[model samples]
Target: MALSPQDLHRIAQSRGWRDGRVEVFDTASGKVTVKGLRATRHAARYHLLNGVARLLGLPFLQAAPMPGGRQAQQTEVARLRALHGVGARVPEVLHVDEDHFVMRWLGQDHLGDVIQSHHPQAAALWREAGDALVRLHAAGQYLSQGFARNMIVDGAPAAPAWPG
Candidate 1:
């Protein structure tokens, strides 16, 4: 099933956020940050969401800390680091909290906003992003939240391959 906008909204609000807000932050040291308070209900929803994510064989709540609270977040990071062994690419998990995670943010503008222009660089990036998805699926995994923002576009597209 597709992620409901309502699900997004509830999770968003549980973090005390609203539309168009900078729930994300950039510290002076070039580190990126996001802040939210942990909500039990929100965490429950994440648990359900995680079930779907695992079925896809992709990381879920990689950003969410476990129940031991702050300590658990550290464990989550250690667990995700192992994904490179299986060929997964995610931003560096910087710091974790009961409610939020900081990562090495490779920033970008909204793809829709930028897509209107036929920039050669952007087109190449899109194709590469698609290929990344294809690679993940070939590993018997997929992103439960299959949206453009979740993807990180590297320099160029990898060669095409048959989709699973």
Candidate 2:
């Protein structure tokens, strides 16, 4: 479902940021999630630092915090659309403005949490996760935030596995 800029703003006002970054808003219409500029800008800084490192003949620098809101959201939307076009599982982008964009709510524990918990199905889960990444890369773009924390698994229980 698409939300207008006003809708996004209204929702943001309703639900404060999570971890001081993401905001999740569930409405009678549908659920919308908003992510701030941290990760996107971090990737930007990574590239900037990477260029400097290359000029100095040094190893690549790690991603650092980037600063910008709307631009970051634009970049993110483009990236998401690209990934979606290539068959990657991603949230549906609803609307975008300068500071943030509204996207269909994708609710689930982060893949990282599940992995850390040693889910009995961890092997299969990891395999599927790796395959998704491979597919995304095969689409000819590297997702800067390709960490397990960024991946969501739908319909999975919020529990850990017992050791066999």
Which numbered prediction scores highest in TM-score against the true structure? 2
Cα lDDT tens digits, model 1, 1-164, are: 12234433444444433233225543443534344433333477667777878877887434453454444545545645554447587656555444555555555544433343444466666776678778888887645455665554443332232121
| Least well predicted 10-residue stretch by lDDT in candidate 2 | 59-68
lDDT by residue (tens digit), candidate 2, 139-162: 776787788898887777767434
Error of 1 at 39 (Å): 5.5
What is the lDDT for 126 in model 2? 82
Task: For residue 159, give model 2's deviation from the true position in Å.
Answer: 2.1
Instruction: Give the number of the best model, judged by lDDT.
Output: 2
Candidate no. 1 TM-score = 0.47
Q: In candidate 1, where is summed lDDT lowest over 10 consecutive residues?
A: 155-164
